[model samples]
Target: MHKVSVIIPVYNVEKYICECLESVMAQTLSTGIECILVDDRGNDASMEAARKCIAGYSGPIKFQLVVRAENGGLSAARNTGINNAKGEYVYFLDSDDIITPDCLNLLVERASEYPDAEIVCGDFQTFPQKDVHKLISLQGKNFPESSFDKSWIRSVFLSSFPVIAWNKLIRTDFIRRNNLYFREGILHEDDHWHAQAYRHVSGLAFVNKVTYLYRMRPGSITMSDGVEERRLENMTLIFSEMFAKEVEWDKPWSDWILKSVGSLRYIGNKANIKEKAEHCVSQLLPTVYKNQSAPFILRLLFKYYFHNGVIFSSRLFYKLYAIYWKYKG
Candidate 1:
């Protein structure tokens, strides 16, 4: 069996797909890697580019292209790739992103060392196409190179480590056995799947190496403008499901909620979506204020805002703070 199955979801990334495929082709452990390309019926020439790259490829890595009949969004495409994966571990990769040559080798090596770890996470860097030289590494000082069992799940979740799916190599059988799948028809599907994995995985390991290079495309859903409403809706649904599952509102959960509120406030202020912002603050502020996991200063700020009926003022304060920091820097 293949050591790792890299699942690349191809949509409208025609311009960047070739580089992504080439990155996979350049993996150090080519013989034990399988690259699964899922074409989600995009109208662009992304599939054509993928086919061309695969056809011209002379690599030892096995490749499979699965073309869906209908366009089912990112979550569905990921599920399709997971369903067809044949490797022991599955790693998600976006069509616009590229991985280092040793990405798979590092992950597989770490997994081999920790045979009981069902999930292994590595660090990553984010870069824009134009500013590729100015890549920003996301390695955290808090995340030591170590293996963690189920007891450390909360600490893992609360650490500076990112919750993104692409940074982790997950055991295929673990995911299937736990019935962990991305939520279909949602934009922020990673949030749910990552939460579930953390909850159910027997153990997880961290590899302190930069393996993945996440490309910050301008038109991507997370970066694009005018998608605030969709983002807010999806995040709300995700949080609601999480709360329903009785996930403790500990420090990590509180931190996530606060960040979510901050994002909603920023988007609302930018787009003048007052009603949505007000509603979200009203629903979330009480829980955020009550949770003791957040920093004392943040909790105090929330308390002041809640008592003073100036919840919206935090947005202005954040903007001014940003400007101050920019000038200071």
Candidate 2:
């Protein structure tokens, strides 16, 4: 067994797979790391590029490739990687992204320090292809370098540290014991799995150093223009499932809703999926309003909408609020 299993889900990332794999090959703690590359039946040369890189790689880490029988999407590809991983900790890496030379070393060091932590997170930086050499810190002021238990899990959820899967090094046993798996065939699968995992984590740790480099490339699923409807539907489904759970109310709930409203408005305006976005807002408003932990302004807005139903419809209000946010930013 290895110390960490870096799972790379390969789709149509032929242009960037070599760089991603090379970063894996250049890990400081290369001896005890296993790189599992899962091919999701992509039509491009991604698999070929991976094979060439792995073939020429002289690193001490173990490398394995799993080819899917058919195209099962990102969730399925990641699930396959998780199922095949033989490491104590699992780290998901996008094929288009790269990690620092000490990424694995830093995460493993933090894990050693916090032996009870089920999840260890490191900061990340995002860059476009042209500016790949530049690094910008995504760490926020509220993110502290400390170890937290389940009691502080909600705070972790509400922190500036992203809820993204790639930024964290998760214990394999914790994920297996909790039966945590990504929802297959969905666009926003990470949100669902992370939401559940956050609730059950026994301990969490943070590494203040930036380790991962997220590439903001065009035509990626999150940045694509044509997938707005599917994205909106997936967002709604995830939030519905999350809100229906009998979890304690907290400020994070309200903050997340408020933050999501901006995305809803963007989807409505860009994708012409206003009806679906409005439906989700209608379903979530009551829950958002009921959470005392939420900001007073958000609750007040919901109350105003409730009392004056005709004057400020959910859709209209979201549109106006999004405008305010745009200008504020």
Candidate 3:
């Protein structure tokens, strides 16, 4: 079997697709890898561009291209690739992001050292963006080191990192055995999947060296107007799904959802979606109460907003605080 199946879900990323593919082709690791490029019905010349880049490729790895008939979203594209993967391990690569030459090599080495590991992750740097730089402190630049657990992930997820498919390599047998696939038609599908995946993980590997480059484009969904509402709705859905599962009730996970809603409220009001912001809070507060052991600070924030009708004020505070930070930075 192939060692790794690098799945790249292609959309309309004509600008960066070539560079992204090249980075994979240049990987120093000569392991059995399958580069499966799934084209999700793009209008642009992205397919043509991808074809040109792959024509001269003569690496040890096998390469294949797939073109889907319908324009399913990112989750569907990824699921398609995963369903067809012929490797012992899988790594999902965003069409627009680029990986370092040694990323696969490092991850494979780490996973080999810990053969029982279901997942292995490495550090990644955001390709120089103005506001993105402000969000991350220089002191926090070191790679993350932690024992993998639901609570550990819940705490780390609070910092608003992109804990999506890109930075990790997953064991294919575990995924297939568990029938784990991205939740179709959900905006933040990764959040939901990771919660469950983290629970089932018998072993995990964290490499504090090497890196991937996540390019920030202005038109990305995170930078769009509709994202605020979608995120709020998505978190509500995720929290409900988590509770319904057979796992133990997770207080930290509940707290994380509240924080997500709180952050959404802050961004929604700034985006002038006050009514929608209130709607999200209403859906989220009941779940917050289920966590009887929640910390006082979070409970207080929830009580003040829900009981005192302080959501509007809460929203305003975030807006002003963001403006101040923008000016100060």
Candidate 4:
């Protein structure tokens, strides 16, 4: 079996597939790595583009193109790749992103160092089309210097959102053993899957340098306006799972709720979400209260309205909130 399987879920990224494929093929490591490309029912000549992209590369790498008949969302595409992965370690890369030549080498090195660790993560750089690149670090507390524990992981996860799966190199067998997979149909599936994965993980390792380069497009889903609602719904789904299984409550749980409240406020600013946003935010508020993270003062802000009162008084609540903020400012 290959040492690492690099899975790329392709949709309509015909413009950037070439560079993405080249980056994988150009890995500095001589270690055996298989590249699995899943085409999720794209009409943008993605199939032909993929074939041409990997045509001339001859290395220890093996490549396969999986074309699904129907158009599944990103989660399903990734799950399909996960199911077909035939390597000891599984690494996920988006079709539009590029990796450094040492990306595979670094992951393999980290995994070898922490042989017992199920997941190994490295830092990545995000480059917007017209703006300078920024490094998005996932190495908050689980890096080479620190020892891993539940609390450390909880803090590390709370430091930022785990939307980019490219920084992680996960063990395939461990995933199968734990029955871990992405949540299909969720906009931010990574948050839920990674949250659950970190719970059972024995250890985590990180590389200091940038290994992956994420090219930010103007209209990417990460930059979309509709993401806030979907993200809130996904977080609600995740917290429900955590509570259902009786996972131990901790400060990070409260922190996550705080982050969700900020997200609700953000969604409240969108004109398109004016109609249903309040109900959605109301649904999310109960979970936030269940965590009891909000300060007493913040909780009092919603005191006039009962726990579920926002569901009925959503429009008025939003209007009053707007007027209050407008004058308060």
Q: After superposing candidate 2 on the true structure, give the runs of residues whose Cα lies further than 4 Å from its correct spot.
A: 129-138, 254-266, 269-273, 283-329
Model 4 segments more than 4 A misplaced: 128-146, 160-163, 224-245, 270-275, 287-329
Ranked by TM-score, the better of candidates 2 and 4 is 2
What is the model-wide C-alpha lDDT for candidate 3? 0.72
The TM-score values for the models, in the order shown, are 0.81, 0.82, 0.81, 0.80
Backbone clash pairs for candidate 3 read none
Q: How do these models rank on lDDT, best leading?
A: 2, 1, 3, 4
lDDT (tens digit, per residue) of candidate 3 on 29-142: 986889999999988998899999999788887888988889898889998998889988999888898999999999988888877778787767778562334233222544
RMSD of each: 7.5, 6.4, 7.4, 6.3
lDDT of every model, 2 decimals: 0.74, 0.77, 0.72, 0.71
Question: Evaluated with lDDT, which candidate comes out highest?
Answer: 2
Candidate 2 lDDT score at position 94: 96
Weakest 10 consecutive residues, lDDT, candidate 2?
A: 130-139
Q: What is the per-residue lDDT of model 2 for residues 277-313, given as tens digits with 9 covering 90 to 100?
A: 6666666555444433334545545654454243335
**Candidate 4 lDDT, tens digit per residue, 281-316?**
545444434433335315434653444334335565
Q: Single out the weakest 10-residue window by summed lDDT for candidate 3.
A: 130-139
lDDT of 1 by residue, 1-329 (tens): 98888999899999999999999998888577888999899889999989999999887888999988899988889889999999999999999999999988888888898878887888777775533222122443555455464446665563444667896889999889989888999887877777666566667677777898888877887889878887777776676566446566566665565566666666666678866765655554444333333354355345445643654766644643343344332
